[model samples]
Target: MKWVLPSLLFSLFFFFLNCTDVDYNEKSVNRTSRKILIDASHDGGVWWSPQSGTYSASLPHQGKLMADFLRSYGFTVDELPSFSVITDSILQQYDKVIRAGCFGTYQPSELQAYVNYTNRPTSLFLIGEYLNPAQIDQLAENLGIHFQGIYYGNLDTYAPHIITDSATSFYYNAGSIIVNAGTNPAIIPLGWLDGDNNKPSLGILQHPFSKILFIGDINGIESLPQPLTLKIFKWLFG
Candidate 1:
């Protein structure tokens, strides 16, 4: 009986170890197989041309850089030039959606569709720049956030977040300010401009099964280090 009890204890220990290993391996596989969608449509405003009426038929460098970064971490990335291609069926295929520098007005149905998608297991990263107040307000209302269309500049530094470094001095050509709307528990601030009375430069809304990360400026991603970028991806993807 003494030997039997010792043997049973040993077996239980080994079983627990095996279960832990399986869980870790499963999480690693999920991260490796994760797919991301980068939306460069809606006048991303990441690239500019000095010559009048000259446009390049190329994806925005910001989107390309972000895609490349995510790809390096074993993530599959898809770049879309227009949100029109996104449907409920299509949105289900991606684990995350990143809309960088978006300034286009969305229809009510389109906004509702996106809201529905966020309510699922899918995550979203909304990057904005220089949008009109009305457009910002509309988006804020739809997403249960408070966004003001005001450019913040001449800033010596910024608040740190999952992606931003505390020591980094940040400046934006045109950046919006976000505040807590108090409508939902999911909506919360992630980062903010320095010395702006805690006005959020980056916000996150954690829905029931999904999440949304909002950045006031897309340029912030361009300046982030690879380590910080990876951290951001981990936060968004996980």
Candidate 2:
């Protein structure tokens, strides 16, 4: 009877160790398995070269740097080609969607698809710089935000948010003005240009199951943006 009890205790000790190891492994895998989709299709001024009779990609250097930066954090980053469209199936494959420096216009169907996608449990990061004013307005309207076509510069003001610290100051070559169009409780302003507290230069909208982060300019991808960009990515991946 004494030998039997010791044998049972030995078995239980090994079993507990095995269970703890499995849980640790599972947590580690989950932490590194996060997926991010960087939509490069609309960026980089993609066009066909008639002389070469082939398509070419003029992807922004900053966008490429952003992808590399994300990969360094152990996140699986997918840079979709310009020919790719944001579809329901495509959106499902990623936990976060980043639309950066997109100048191309979206079709009505594609816009509707984005609307549907944003209404779901997803995270969208919208970065625009010198994009089509009409397209920007369209997107703002769809998101229930007001976007003025005018570009603001010399912005020395910032609202404190997850992506910025109290000492952080930001300036953009050019940026659009965005503000909440209605009294939607879900929309929250993140930052604003100096002397212009009424309009938001950066904002986040939280839906029931989804969230959207809007940046008026692509300066966040620049080297000077520094900790702001890093903090933004952390917030997104978190």
- 1-238, model 2: which lDDT tens digit per residue? 7799999999999998887653221323236438888765565432111212233234344455667666666677787666567776777677688876555567777678777777777778877655444656455567776656556564456666656664366665566667553466766776767756775677777767666887767654444365667666656655
Instruction: Provide backbone clash counts, one per model.
Output: 0, 1
lDDT for 204 in candidate 2 is: 78
How displaced is residue 134 in candidate 2, in Å?
Answer: 4.9
TM-score against native, each model = 0.72, 0.72
| lDDT, candidate 1, 26-94, per-residue tens | 334344447887765554446221212333334345445667766666677776554344566766677
Q: After superposing candidate 2 on the true structure, give the runs of residues whose Cα lies further than 4 Å from its correct spot.
A: 1-33, 44-60, 131-135, 152-155, 181-184
Predictions in order: lDDT = 0.62, 0.63
Can you give the lDDT of residue 179 in candidate 2?
Answer: 53
Cα miss at 215, model 1 (Å)? 1.2
Position 150, candidate 2: lDDT: 53
